[model samples]
Target: MRLSRAFIRAVSSPATVAWRSAQSRIFCSSPSDYRKSQPSMLKHLTSKIKATGPVSVAEYMREVLTNPVTGYYVRNNMLGPDGDFITSPEISQVFGELLGVWIISEWMAAGRPKQLQLVELGPGNGSLAADVLRVFGQLQSVLGGASVSLHLMEVSPALSDFQAQTLTGGGSQKADCEEDPVYRHGTTAAGLPVSWYRCLEDVPAGFSIFVAHEFFDSLPVHKFQRTEKGWREVLVDVDPEDSGKLRFVVSPGPTLASATLVQANERRDHIEVCAEGGVIIQQLARRILNDGGAVLIMDYGHDGTKTDTFRGFKDHQLHDVLLSPGSADLTADVDFSFLRRMAGGGVACLGPVTQGLFLKNMGIDTRMQVLLRNCHDPSTRKQLINSYDMLTNPTKMGERFLFFSLLHPSRLAAPTKPHGLKLEKRSPVLLPVAGFTDLSFS
Candidate 1:
């Protein structure tokens, strides 16, 4: 699809226009002044693009959404009702509560380790963690008072502060100091008391539960397009016209370095390599295989054939991936196939399940029904329905978001191969008989 004119305008003057709209409530403004500021910005952007070669979609998105100082994520509050978009936990308490239940279940299945590590990647505002812990506290007696050590893998200091605040508030509400969760910050493998020389090596050897929601998609991705000659890797460089502008340009790099790019060459033009995300997945899988544990990956993606899934988001609206320099959100779809393959042997990989189906299977509907039973006002009831729809409606986020689970081999009674490993499916009789119930319910 071609870039929209509206997106062009937004990208060109994102700072002036987006900031004004975002902060409008804080500082009321007249429409006339806003209109006057737009043309100049467009002219500047047009001149810059002309001087520079056509920017790639990825380059445009990286600049507009993630520019070090002036990027949207850096300058704006991009979460909750006031921000550009809302995440699942931000949408409702029940979402996190349910996820907590899942984690507790996994913890129990791991034989209830004495020193259990609960880790979250890119824990925005830590709302999900707080909610999960609240539910977890309620089930502590059954799960046993397992020493809980909370670790958060976050990059942004701004987000770290927000996470600290949320954890503190939630921890205060818990019954006692012993029950209060310990908080640490760094990459999933870094922040925790784990030692490793490399990214994959950093994962501490232990029975741990890992959760990453809306995390993988944000990692840097390499874009590629197939041609008669071969596939090429995309790179970002500064645009000459606008001193501060950056644009996507092809890099003369070997495609073999990127497995996804090498595989995508057989397909049509335009593909994305989330090699970074895949590497992280492999690391997690290795951790599970070598030590023991489970990982819950939740994000928007597909379980179908491969295709170009790179895109951008600004102020809750989709925009051309190549619109601005470091000012917008740049992301590519998660390839569960790649993850499944990377997990290799001896791992039980489950579901690229639809968020709607998974949540429903996990009792979201039952929870909603319970809430509606006590809800007295019609307006409040309607609001609850809307929230549910936002979460589960296919066109909304329900079908779009996907959930995948990776479990340790020892925990599963059956012999299982990782996804995409080309292993033959065993018969029901031959398969391990340990059901999901064999795992402890935290």
Candidate 2:
């Protein structure tokens, strides 16, 4: 729907209004101000919807999460305690250190490539990268510094600056000229200088170890619900009460459009389709297949065959994603099946293991024991115990979070299928729809 010039001006900043107006006059007659001014676009959408029909939840979500000016990721700082939620690296240095060890093991498994590209996608504040690098720095004899190149793929200029500071061991305000890890502004797969692209093709063809922690879940997801009539897609559109807000709206669109949304039992009420995540995984898989490498993905999600998992967070508190356009974090559960499929036929998929089990298997308990033995203060010991509990508790982040890995056939032996891959049946003693509401986009 077309938005009026006056309406755009009403919701846009003076500078934005002036720039957009100039662009409109010079490039096109239609006011494209809505591209930058989310409030205006939402307002326009809401007004049009009253006259039209209800918008689909997918359309609504696409607009609010990706709208250039007001979409969530485009306009907001979405990581860390101050933002929506704190990721593992942000929670403790130990997490990244252990990951570094995991990556090094994977590299060794790859026959220790003389020239290895260590790549990370959506590296927030670069904390994980820095921690990994620090750990690797100590194992220089095994890692041959000259042979390894660190590459980070990020988009936010603010985050890029933060990542640089974190990686260089400098104050947040200062830029380190000497400590540079090749930084790319966009997708490494795209052909933008082995640095910037919309996808992975941008990365130079080579053996690389990839890390994506708390990454995939953030990608936009298409929500679907099983109904007697068939499956319908959910959409996001402007909310009527708040001109600046966006809300989930269901649409009559067929679910077949989303490859991840396969036909399911008629009783299942919701499902999520992660087309973007699938595409990314497939691209990475193909790269690994062509060139020997491995990838590790860690995040909170279920490995079940059928379930709808969609939710939002803001300021460490659960918030209605529809409250504000581009202001809160919108996310959904990751489907490891899609990831495995994307790896084509040859790559090996591992885990879907509980974070608790993964960490314990990796010797977190031993690490904790060593730390406790070294510590003197009782308070410090208490703190460590508390943190350990929080990290290991099944009801908390421990059991709920999961870890999965993909490896090339030549690099590592195929992982034995994890025993915990099956979905647990909910006790009938609990409400029949107990878990059902938890998956709602609303």
TM-scores for the candidates: 0.71, 0.74
- For candidate 1, the 10 contiguous residues with the lowest summed lDDT are 20-29
The lDDT of each candidate is: 0.58, 0.59
lDDT of 1 at 310: 72
Candidate 2 residue runs with Cα over 4 Å from true position: 1-59, 169-198, 238-247, 253-261, 264-267, 412-442
Which structure among the candidates has the greatest TM-score?
A: 2
Error of 2 at 265 (Å): 7.4
Q: Per-residue alpha-carbon lDDT of model 1 for 31-143, expressed as tens digits?
A: 22122233332344445445553333333444554555555555555677666567999888878877876676566656666767777777877899878777766656755
lDDT of 2 at 217: 83
Model 2 per-residue lDDT tens digits across residues 246-287 = 445444334333222444543457777566676678777777
Off by over 4 Å in 1: 1-76, 170-205, 237-260, 304-306, 414-442
